[model samples]
Target: MTSPSDAPEGTEPGTEPGTEPGTEPGTVRPGGRTARVRAAVLEAAGDMLAEQGFHGLDLAEVARRAEVGKTTVYRRWGTVAGLVADLLTDMAEQSLPRAETGSLEGDLLANARLVRRTLSDPRQGPLFRAVIAAATGDARTAEALHRFYEVRVAEWAPCVREAVERGELPAGTDAAEVVRAVSAPLYYRLLTTDAPLDEDAARRAAAAAVAAARAGAFVRTP
Candidate 1:
């Protein structure tokens, strides 16, 4: 797995830097230097992304910002799509651990709030929009975007499954889809409307999703 600092530079089809934060259970390594480098690269990439958009980025400039060699950037990530893929992977690996609130409603609420916060972030939202635009023209960029969401959904699926097991939700609920539902509106707000992504929105989304799950909206049809 790539570290935070190892994110490549570019705004091309595959050029998005990412960071993998947090620990991997049962895996240990002396990672101090590596972690610092990864963090530096990701931060620099984000700064560039927010300041200049995707088209404004170049690998050489990223190397300059990262204080690494252009060759190093090229060797690690060959294409723009490769860089974005690494960035997406780093994001997945480093994102906060999923919440386990012991109830589907609580967990979904937590997820909604977190998603709102992320999409509403001043730095991240524009960067995301830039990437989304880029993805429209690049298949690899689109794939990376899909994987990013997939990882997030998978991380929260257990909470939905647990609810089903506890009879708080009907059996046969597609846990990942249930998890995704809570964030759909949050992203909708981020992308479509200028509506504030406040606590109220988060709570409402979560409550609605939980209600839907209980009503068997998530059950897989035979």
Candidate 2:
């Protein structure tokens, strides 16, 4: 996934090009060699995370796998947590945009299906699980993960607002809440059971969110 790099076009904004201290995950993407290095490092890091979990992630190993110098990896991302946080930011930037299907049900169904596909993907599924598991104990990782979802929710919130305008949902239906509701069940299934995230499940998730939303279950409260 393409992440927002903290650098101007064709230049990395850090102590030494792509080194850390001032480099945040989302600012501007770097260009040329710096961009390639970042991409390679993150790609290698993701593969290792999917295969070895957080505890097994090593900066030296990541550098070796990415074919970059270990010193570069250490300088850019000082700690494992820092690297993971950047990885989450990259994922957020790479996520798909929300669907605009006109009807709430249609839109939510599309959302549910997208979640299903991502959560069920061979590579992404495990990667997400590993990151989520790591987030439970690491504060930085959790914050970065929150940012990822915030970006996605913000992207999809407009559909709920549009539905309100069309009278498909209540006037004050919590758009973000409704959007979250659409995916909650699918995520629950993914995390709790070995159930397949099939078309029927996606339909059910969308239908339930639509039903609850139409009934004002997601209305904002004090």
Residue-level lDDT tens digits of model 1 in 14-126: 22233233323111222455445555656667677777877776767877899976664664455666666566667778888889888887899999988888777888777
lDDT of each candidate versus the true structure: 0.74, 0.84
* 1-222 per-residue lDDT for model 2 (tens digits): 112374445544444354344655333365667778888988999999989888899999999999998766776677888888888888888888888777888889999999999999988888888998999999998998899899988999999999999988888889999999998999899889998889999999999999999998999877
Name the best candidate (by TM-score). 2
Those runs of model 2 whose alpha carbons end farther than 4 Å from true positions after fitting are 1-14, 18-28
The whole-model C-alpha lDDT of candidate 2 against the native structure comes to 0.84
User: Residue 206 error for model 1, in Å?
Assistant: 0.8
Give candidate 1's whole-model lDDT. Answer: 0.74
Q: Worst lDDT window (10 residues) for model 1?
A: 21-30
